[model samples]
Target: MKRRSNLLTIGMLALLVYFLLPLFWLVVASTKSTGDLFSSFGLWFTADFHLFQNIGQVFTYGDGVYGRWLLNTLFYSVVSAGGAAFLCALGGYGFAKFRFRGNSTLFGVVLAAVMVPTTALAIPTYLLFSKIDLVNTPWAIILPSLVSPFGLYLMRIYAQDAIDDSMIEAGRIDGASEMGIFFKIVLRSLAPGIVTVLLFTLVATWNNYFLPLIMLNDPELYPITVGLAAWSSQTAGGGGSTGDLLALVVTGSMLSIVPLIAAFLLLQRYWQSGLSAGGVKG
Candidate 1:
């Protein structure tokens, strides 16, 4: 038993190190000048830290392009994720609670849509949006992101367990409308599920690169991921080597991950409890 425990502990530690090594490297690399990044310590802190200088350059380079990218990303992430979550909740609630013609068929279609790779549809979506003159706009990203089949599925499953039919029936008996009952009672009970869905959609939209890559053409409309990639590529190819955009890219990558980490930490309990309840009931 002792031997097994020791082996398991070592294995877990190794896995943790494996995952964290890249992040540690990024932090160390971001502090180094381009020259130092290649020449200095690969995994440890530098003797001379240039983090502040690098950050300044990251903002000032290309006329504050990073700032624009950051704003675009925030807009896309918040609008798409929040909108998608609300739509999913509505769809899920309706599917779980209400009966209508072709409901099962529509849900089956949604399931099939979930099975489809979002990346695979990017080209077609681009073409469709182009025909409507919506390409290169924020709507190009937000509209597509607003329809999350998986989120809808998650909500349906969550609503089925989190909300009870009896409550809706009671609300009806008390002369409450469907929307009122949903808003007043069902929604409150499904708080955990809503948070879970919001986080999932938020992370998905925030990290999304491929769709935005295909949809938007204007440099001014670029999200941070695409914008950072452009800068990183240029820096990697030694376009100008103006204060190590590459280093800032590393740092920016590190910074971008912070929001995701904080969100998970803050919502971990709700997400876990929601999943546990859904699983137990399902």
Candidate 2:
């Protein structure tokens, strides 16, 4: 038993190091100038402290375009994630509580959609959006992101476990409308699932790169991820060697993940509880 315990402890510690090492490197790299970044040992601080300088450059570069990109990211993430969560909740609640024709078949389709990679659909989506004149607009990003099959599945499972049919029936007996019961009671109970979907959708939209890159042509309309990638690309083939855009790219990458980290930290308790409840019940 002691030997097994010792081995497990060592294994856990190794896993911790494996995950933390890259983050440590990114932090250390962001604090150094480009020269120091290339020359110095990774995962350790250098004598020069350039984190603030790099971040400032990131925002001010190209006439403060980074700030615009950050705002665009915030807009896209909030709108898409919020809409997706609501839709997921509605779909999940309906699937969990009500019966309709071909319900299981429809859910199976959703599961199949989940298995399909979004990247594979990007071109078809682009063509469709172009026909509708939505390409190169914020809708191009927000609209596609608003449909999350995984979120619907998660909410379906969560609703099944969290809400009781008896309560819903009682609400109906009291002459409450279905929407009224959902809004007043089911919604409150679905809080954890909603937050879980929100976080997932938020992260997905915020870090989305390929879709926006394909959809939006205007640099001003770019999200942080795409903007950072553009800056990162400037270093290719010795093109942006005259500027600190590469350093700015690294620092910006570090800053870009802050919101995601903060969100997870704030909602972790609810997220964990929701998953546990859903798992145990279903």
Candidate 3:
């Protein structure tokens, strides 16, 4: 048993290192100057620490365009995630509790949609949006992001167990309207599941790259992911200022992940409970 425990510990340590190594490297690299990046070992800091300078350059470059991308990302992610979570909760709750015509068929369709890749739908979605004259707008990104088949599925599974039919019936007995019951009673019961879907959609929309890249032609509409990729492409194209741009990209990359990390840390308990409860119920 002691030997098995030792092996488990080693395995856990290895997994920790595997996940955190890149983040560690990013922190180290972000502190180094462009020249120090290449000259010094990647995992360690050097004499020249330009962390703040690199961050300043990241914001000030191209007349503070990175800050604009940051704001765009925040808007797209928050709006999309919040909307998607609410919609998913509504759909999932209905599917879980209500009896309607063609209910099984519609639920099956949602299940099928969960299997379809978003990348496969991107071009078709773009074309549809173009016809509606919504292309190259924030809606181009936000509208598409609001549809999350996986999140719907997750919420459905969670709602099945998290909410009780008797409780809902009791709310109705108390003269609560459908929407009122959902807002006051059902929502409180589904808090963990809602949070789980919110975090999933939030992260997906935050790191989204290809959809925005293909949909938005305006740089002002670019998210941090695409803006950083653009800077990376410039660095690869080989200019005399490539080094400075490279450092800015590194620092920006590190800064971009901070919000995601904080989100995970803050909502981890709810996320864990949601997943575990859903798994057990499913």
Candidate 4:
């Protein structure tokens, strides 16, 4: 038993290092000047530290275009994640508690959708949005992100066990309207599930690249993912100024992940509880 435990411990430590090594490298690389990036060892910092300078360049480049991209990301992620979570909670609650025609069939369709990759739907979604003249607009990103089949499925499973039929019945007995019951009672109960879904959608939208690339041609409207990619492409092309842009890209990449890390840290408890509850119920 002790031998087995030691092996497991060693395995877990290796996995941890594997996951964190790149992040460690990113932190180390961000502190180096672009020239030192290639000259110095990747895993360690050099004599000169340029993290602050790189960050300033990231924001000041192209007249603070990176700041615009950062704001766009925040807007898109927050709006889309919040809307998707709410819609998922509503749809999930309906599927879980209400009896309706085609309930099973519709839910099965949603389950099937969960298996379908969002990338596959991107072109079709873009075509549909083009017909509606939403192409190149923020809606092109926000609207599509608001629909999460997986979040709906998660909320359905969570709501099934998170909410009790008797509490809903009691609310209805008191003449609470459907919307009132949802907002006043059901939503409160769905907090953990909602936060879980919110975090999922938030990260997805924040990291989204291809969709925004296809949807928006305007650089000002780009998210951090797309914006950093643009900078990376510039670096790839190789010029006298490539080193500067490369440093900006690395620093920007590090800065972009900060919010996601903060979000996971802040919501870790709720996320864990939601997963635990879902696991138990499943």
Candidate 5:
């Protein structure tokens, strides 16, 4: 038993370091100058402490471009996540509760789409959107963000266990319309599932780099991920005077992840409760 406890402690420590190592490096890098980044050790702080200055430079660079990118990220993540959650709830509830023509086939298609990654569809999506003039627009991101096969699957599973057919029948017997029952009764019970889907969609949309890279050419339209990547690229040889901008890039990257962290913390309880409850029910 003592040996097993030691092994468990070691395992937990290893997992902790594995998760926190990158974040630790990121925090250390954000406070460094470009020269210090190259000369000093990767994990430790250098003699020069430039965190605040680097943060200022990040926002001020390119005439406050990082701020615009941050706002763009906020907008995209919030709208996309909310819309995705709503759609997921509607679809999941329908699939879980209602019997319709081709329902299984349609759900199966969604599951199949889940197997095909979004990255694989990027170029094709870009071409399709380009033809429709949706390229370089927020719609390019927003429209695609609304469709989450995984979110739908999660909600469908949760709705099944969370809401019993007896409950639906009870509502219907009370002369409630299907939509009315959904809004009043179903919404209250599906809270955890909705939060789970919202958090998933929020993170996915927040950190999306590849999709926006192809969809948007305008810097104003670029989300934080794409904007920071563009900055990071400038430090390469022959990439221009961006060698001095490395600190800003690192700091900007750090800043960009703050909202995501806050979001996870805020929604974490709901996420855990919902997932664990769903797991037990399943």
Candidate 6:
């Protein structure tokens, strides 16, 4: 038993190190000057530091374009995550609680949608948005992200246990309207599941690259993922100023991850509860 426990501990530590090592490298690399990056050390300490200088250059270079991308990413992430969570909650509540026509069939279709890859739908979505002149706008990203099939599925499963039908009925019996009952009773009860869905949507929208790559053409409208890719390409192409875009990209990647980390920390308890309660029948 002791041998097995030691082996398992070592294995888990190795896996943790494997995932964190890349992020550690990015942090150290972003702080080092270009010369020091290549010559001084691969994973060791750098003799010459350029952390502040690189950050200044990242903001100032290209007329502060990185700031624009940062804002766009935030906007897209907030809207998509919040919208998707709300929509999923509504849809899931309706499917789980209401006795509507063809609810099972409709839910089956939604389940099928969960099986479909978002990437496969990107081309059709781009075409549809382009026809409506919504392409190249943040809506192009935000709208599609709001339609999360997995979120719908998660909410459906979560709503089954997270919310009680008796509570909703009591709310209705207490002179509450349908909307009032749903908003006041059901939604409040499903808070944990809502946060879970929000986190899922936020992460997906934040890291999404391929959909934005196909939907958008204007660089000014690019999310951070797309913007970073463009910068990487420019690095390869020897673009103007020869600024340390690599460092900026690295620092920006770190900055981009901060919001997610903060969000997880804030919502971890709710997320854990929601997941644990999902599909757990009374």
Question: lDDT per residue, candidate 4, 1-282, as tens digits?
Answer: 999999999999999999999999999989988888989899998879899999888899989999999999999999999999999999999999999999999999999999999889989999999999999999999999999999999999988988989999999999999999999999977989999899999999999988998899999899999989998998899887666898888889999999999988998888677678768866
Error of 3 at 200 (Å): 0.6
Predicted structure with the largest TM-score when compared to the true one:
4
Cα lDDT of model 1 by residue, 1-282, tens digit: 999999999999999999999988888887887778788779987888988888787788788988888888888888888898888888999999889999999999999999999899999999999999999999999999998999999999988878888999999999999899988988777878778788888888889999998888899999988988887778757755445676888777776777788878988887687677778867
Q: Over all chains combined, what TM-score does candidate 6 have?
A: 0.92
Backbone Cα, N, C clashes tallied per candidate:
0, 0, 0, 0, 0, 0
Off by over 4 Å in 1: 1-11, 241-243, 272-282
The lDDT values for all models are 0.86, 0.91, 0.92, 0.93, 0.91, 0.86
Tens-digit per-residue lDDT, 1-282, candidate 6? 999999999999999999999988888887877667667776866767787888887777779888898899999999999999999999988888888899899999999998999999999999899899999888999999999888998888878867877898798779999888888888877888889899999999999999999989998999889988888787778755655677777777776787888989988987666566664643
Which whole-number lDDT from 0 to 100 does residue 206 have in model 5?
Answer: 92
- Worst 10-residue lDDT window, candidate 6: 273-282
Best model per lDDT: 4
Candidate 5 structure quality by residue, lDDT tens digits, 147-261: 9999999999989889978889999999999999999999877988999899999999998999999999999999999998887777765355676788888889888889989
- lDDT, candidate 2, residue 96? 89
Ranking under TM-score, best-scoring first? 4, 2, 3, 5, 6, 1
Candidate 5: regions farther than 4 A off: 238-240, 272-282
Clashes of 6: 0
Each model's TM-score, in the order given? 0.90, 0.94, 0.93, 0.95, 0.93, 0.92
lDDT of 5 at 167: 85
Which scores greater on TM-score, model 2 or model 6? 2
lDDT of 2 by residue, 68-187 (tens): 998999999999999999999999999988999999999999999999998998999999999999999999999999999999999999898799899999999999999999999899
